[model samples]
Target: MKKYVQEATDINVWTSLKEDTFDRGKDIREFIEGLELIEGNAFISLDAKWGDGKTFFVRQIEETLKYFRAKQMETEEKLLKDLESYEYLKESVAVKETTVEHIYLPVYYNAWMYDDHNDPLMSLLLVMTKQCGGAYNTKINTKSLGERLLAVASSLPISIKKINPATIIKDLQEGKMDILSAVKTEEDIKECVRDVFNDIIVEEAEKLVVFIDELDRCKPSFAIEMLERIKHYFDDERIIFVVSLNKEQLIHTISNYYGSEFDATRYLNRFFDVSINLPEISWYQKQKVQCTNSERFWITLIADELSDYYGFSLRDKLIYKSSIESLPRDVGDAFSQDKMYLNIFEVIIVLLDMVDAKEKKAFLEGKSNILIDLMPRIEIYKKYILRSFGIDIRDDCEEKLTEKYKLVQEVYEYVFGRDTEEYFKEADISRNLKEICIKACNGLKS
Candidate 1:
């Protein structure tokens, strides 16, 4: 029998602390604290490019809110107990409210993960219904909401099985069932659902904080529906929604929906109370020396060599590094030499916008001839691709792609001599190269 243990640094937002190197987590917590200080429903957006870890940041926000809520609940409980004991000791009964300020029940809904569903409203309702029965007060009666959800879902045009309401409730929480289509003429349903949702929220907790994540990754229509539904149905004073998305992509999605002539930015303005952009990761931090692993060093070395022309920001350089780092296992150890790393990364960046995943994998992992075969394309990337993008890679002797290529060739020649290509073909350099790259890139960019 084997048991598994959780890794401490496994990218779990709940367990991980805010990285001091980045201010995103701190800013998000401040925003949440601001919301907690006030009353009424609020809509906040966490804006970042796709793959910038918006979900991770949102998870951190969720955990922080939960932590505060738990602490408040404990204080409230203790105060209530002390009050009761005092009343008993004095032989006089007194009544006082036990509710604490800013106690919230958080619901985390990944919108993109439910893209197969046609109804954003149903997806939200399902999650809310289940979350209502969670560790909060048992008197909240989410069971009624769950039954209502099932009834509404069954009334839709799809062919759903005769699921037990009990089973439906269980499955909904576990994400085993999806609530698909809504009945035609959804206004009545929307109002009814909204009423129930608001009632449950008000009765159960001080506020309902729903974090809608990955909206940018959802289908355009689905994403639009999510916003519309939130605005129209879930706009209770005690409800707060935190959405994570790439704002530019969302603007594009809006334009696609309402036509290119639509003033998407103005249109989108009404949906969010606050829009926070996650700052790009810094290449350097003040007062602290950054850690650079071996793999990151290789990527960073090349990126630094080209930064003067490419103008790759820390984020852009890291993104490019990710592409190179994803190269297959077969060519793993063949890219250690500083020159080889630079030359290979240069090629990958140029061809990145062209090659599909499979093609890139094949090209990277193809025998010892990988570098040699890529030699012909070196001139092409430097000439046509780089210059077309207004970049000149051969700025100085230090930045010449030709020199980098020559160094790689020389290294192979020195190591393998007459059988240089064959030696690389036979070489197995496989010591956690990806981990090395991550460490390097995590350090100061230079």
Candidate 2:
């Protein structure tokens, strides 16, 4: 049961016994330690494919804040400087900036509304107020500076309500109650933005490390706008903006929406201070279980992870292997008959990658998008085998990339003929490129 399998035999990638979750490894520790030291805005990039547990790490931040505050969401100390997490008003910075601060707290989660970038700072201001436990006062938006303050005053005591209707109106004529003293128009609301930081510090509690998951998730048109907002108005080092981004997704979103007006990396280069890539490492449980079957189970599990990471689906590697009365002849071969009939992905990835772009595009239009996208990759692989090692056709491309690979001798015959030396270019393989190709080959193989 312990063996490598091709993608053709597999499906449903999630069922692998190998777990994918954040476990606070060395990479995470290093990144956080580095992040804690920075004084100004910075940029960091964590390279990871989807499902590699980026979100899990962000949750760790939230957990740290919870521990610092003893799980109290709104303790008076919740707004304090030393606390791990906090909330506050714009008017309180000077008092709080000495310790933990929330200068112009970022309000940057788009909830999939990536197009909402035009007024990101304004949108951010709205969200920041909410984050600090402040409610949106709808009526205040329409009122004059004095009237807005009157509204805040009106919310205070029932006594004010009792005296208000006619007398309060009369007092307004006399200019007795300066209701406008506290707050005012939209501009003034923004003016109150800095107070949130001061409030958090004076509270003498933990600092709130707020992570805005993915500003990059927003559309490119809004990306620069959003970036500018973060750069210019709402600047603070203590309030960390932890982002969860897949680089390619960020790039595609940017190019599609922004017409390549700005380089995504160059633009993003300004924000992230520290980043750590979460790798898909071996998923073996280190704790020794004395169960009799533990060794067997562990062996099978490790094989499963290796297979999955190499592009085999759980269904193909496990379920189909055990089922299907007639065993798949040459089950995991990149070009085996049973595999070709059972799953189409293996063929598709190769065809798409090797074919002319226009041809690939036309084929993609006529075929399933999944297969279309997969085909090109497969073709690049097949062509590489043909061109590099002269191992075309039945001779798999990946085998040439591996160290001491196991394969039928016929594979070599089909690829480089009897004389492997005529095409195997020793000088052509640079160490750097060799390792990369080797890993890529291994990824495709097992």
Off by over 4 Å in 1: 1-11, 18-25, 75-101, 135-142, 149-164, 167-187, 202-204, 285-300, 303-446
Instruction: Provide the overall lDDT of each model, using Cα atoms, as 2-decimal numbers.
Output: 0.55, 0.38
Per-residue CA lDDT of model 2 for 21-58, tens digit only, reads 22343344445455556555454455555544454445
C-alpha-based local distance difference test score of model 2: 0.38
Q: Which candidate number would show the highest TM-score if scored against the true structure?
A: 1
Off by over 4 Å in 2: 1-22, 25-28, 39-47, 71-118, 126-190, 199-202, 255-262, 273-446
Give the C-alpha miss distance for residue 148 in model 1, angstroms.
4.0
Q: After best superposition, candidate 1 residue 174: deviation in angstroms?
A: 10
Error of 1 at 105 (Å): 2.0
For every model shown, what is its TM-score relative to the native structure? Answer: 0.60, 0.43
